[model samples]
Target: MLFDLHEAAANRVSTTQRRNTTTGASAASAMASSLTASRANGLGGLDTAFTSTEDLNCKENLEQDLGDDNSNDLLLSCPHFRNEIGGEYERNVSFSRASAGSPGGSECRLAEPALSTYRTNASISVLEVPKEQQRTQSRPRQYSIEHVDLGARYYQDYFVGKEHASYFGVDEKLGPVAVSIKREKLEDHKDHGPQYQYRIIFRTHELITLRGSILEDATPTAMKHGTGRGLPLKDALEYVIPELNIHCLRLALNTPKVTEQLLKLDEQGLSRKHKVGILYCRAGQSSEEEMYNNEEAGPAFEEFLSLLGEKVCLRGFTKYAAQLDVKTDSTGTHSLYTTYQDYEIMFHVSTLLPYTPNNRQQLLRKRHIGNDIVTIIFQEPGALPFTPKNIRSHFQHVFIIVRAHNPCTDNVCYRQLLSGQTLPCPHCVPEHVPSHCSSHWRNDLLMWLLPH
Candidate 1:
């Protein structure tokens, strides 16, 4: 069987060689005939005739090879032939077979003449795209504002109104305080999902005379004060100026004209006050002694008091202390007086006031806070909700509800407790208002409340 197979293969090889010789001779004759026809016509006709003859030769050769199934296998097996014409031969065969199978065989053959010529010179004939086309194709995408739903609510309706008043610290004395809280979608905070941007506008009437005086006195004092509080003199000035401005603005807002306008602005809300009053109320503690002596409530209450008007290292050091007439009590029994940002804040503690006989409501403590425009209600964790309706005070327009956070669980709560007890500032620092809405509120007040 091996001897017979060898003999058949040798015969096939001889037949293929003979056919190749004949095909070469026929191709030469066809080329000569085409050249003769082109000369009789024109130069253009010469190109057309040459292309047509070459295509015809390639097609005939491809068809002949295809008819003999063993031709490709034999050529590929021979290393010399495969290296010389394997790629070109395969491409031409594929083109020929595709044209023959397709319905538009004649059109394809005419359209795609001189395939080898095109393939060889493709690198030199690269088509360039026009600059205009490139500009149109690579243009930046237009983002439409109309398609974006911001879903922003009105300032009063969203913040100061009854809806989210619990989460915010609204001071009626500051006039119209607008908190423009914007949220942007963020991928980093997948759990939280959005980053909040707070832009707070304190629309208090400008006190040019008071501001000028405060700046003149405080500027020199602040420069001399140095960076004792870990803040630069410039930063300290920035902090002091805004606070003093707020203080003066609060006083200016109390003028008959501004007070009437404020009343008209929010009639249904609590009446305006000159000073921000804070009242500490604890559940199940009626007497001053009982409230201060309690384990859980006492510590939290003292912490809150210390936060408001904690004693500074340099007593009466700032010019604001003299300007605001802030007299630190030696006894520390009176309403704790502390100057924050040059503004004097007097915290009216419920326990410190005289407990009236058979009066659990404590009208004495109420007298001080009820008259104030903006009142902060500091309640223990399990304390009853101290509503504005219960106070029955017309002057207290805004109620800021503050609850003691669990020091073991809440990070801010723990930090605040530590800072209050250990870290005493040279200047009276403003108490940080804790918000349940967003964590951004913790430090944002210092940044956003800067005077423009």
Candidate 2:
């Protein structure tokens, strides 16, 4: 969206200038000369001038109407247009003509034959007819590319599903981040039949690449590094990493329908009974606000948690992550603690504050959304050992919650730290606390930084 149309225009003009300088005459002149010569003779000879005014007018009109056709012809003729094999022009022509059917077969024959007869028999001066057609033909075919739309494919499938968005803690000054997917290994599967690997590329920190392999694991194994991470036997890998999770998050957000669907799912409610918890900054927040269920909209999310206590499964609980109160830029607020449970599996949702009352209610529709507690059971059949590291790794499967204030607060904070700054959110900084400068800080100091 930031691309400049003017710059694109300038680039096209400059490219044209370069081509003209290298090839001697501009494309317009070459086309004009070819057309003029074709008209004067029988389109096969050097010059024998057509004298009839009607013939001249028809020739000029044909040239004007075939403006892009003339450019195409000229480009085909140019030696520079030839590919390494020297057959590109012919191939292109073949491709073009294959798609271009005759207007109406025999009934819609071109007027070339009648014009030819008029030229051969009449004696009216060529200059007597209008010069408008010739002048117009001599001008550029500036709007030609619109005839065959390119890059329209990228915008086509965008209307289908929910869009999932993930924020990579990035600096605003680094420009917009671009994402792309790369697939590696085309070979057939060896022991397990066949397998493929995909790497998602993001333009963060100049270039940060994450690769993930889909083997027998329900969750794919991820490698958070460059493509240099070599592939090995699927069994040899211990656990799948979280890199692929981020890739999935970003890609989902890119699709509008996907995002809508994910949000809709939260509103519709999941099949499983919901358990809830609420974690919010209490700095600027007043105690008058008690976590409650909306009577009009069924029981409150917190009530569901107490109702489903042991009936569900609290497989494990994690200390609520604590951080300085970001909204007030103060250290008075308590950090939120989160508990992990398994009604079915472990599901994590880290989100920004929901804005409107409706939006907040929609978020509260799910137990995990209300109480930051995840309760999705691992779907794999076999029971296995679970550790802190495994839980952390699986936590990468996160769904986004909209931030009420800043959508990119976390990303902004991450970039500031990467750039050697450890300040709190700028908007929330209070007047009383001493300004925490970026420099002259101990590396070991645990500075409370905020993510938007």
Candidate number of the best lDDT: 1
List ranges where model 1 is wrong by over 4 Å. 1-274, 283-297, 311-332, 407-452
Cand. 1 Cα-lDDT: 0.33
Alpha carbon lDDT of each predicted model: 0.33, 0.25
What is the model-wide C-alpha lDDT for candidate 2?
Answer: 0.25
- Models, CA RMSD each: 42.8, 33.0
TM-score of each: 0.28, 0.15
Candidate 2 residue 154 C-alpha distance from true site, Å:
4.4
Clash pairs, candidate 1, are 270-397, 273-373
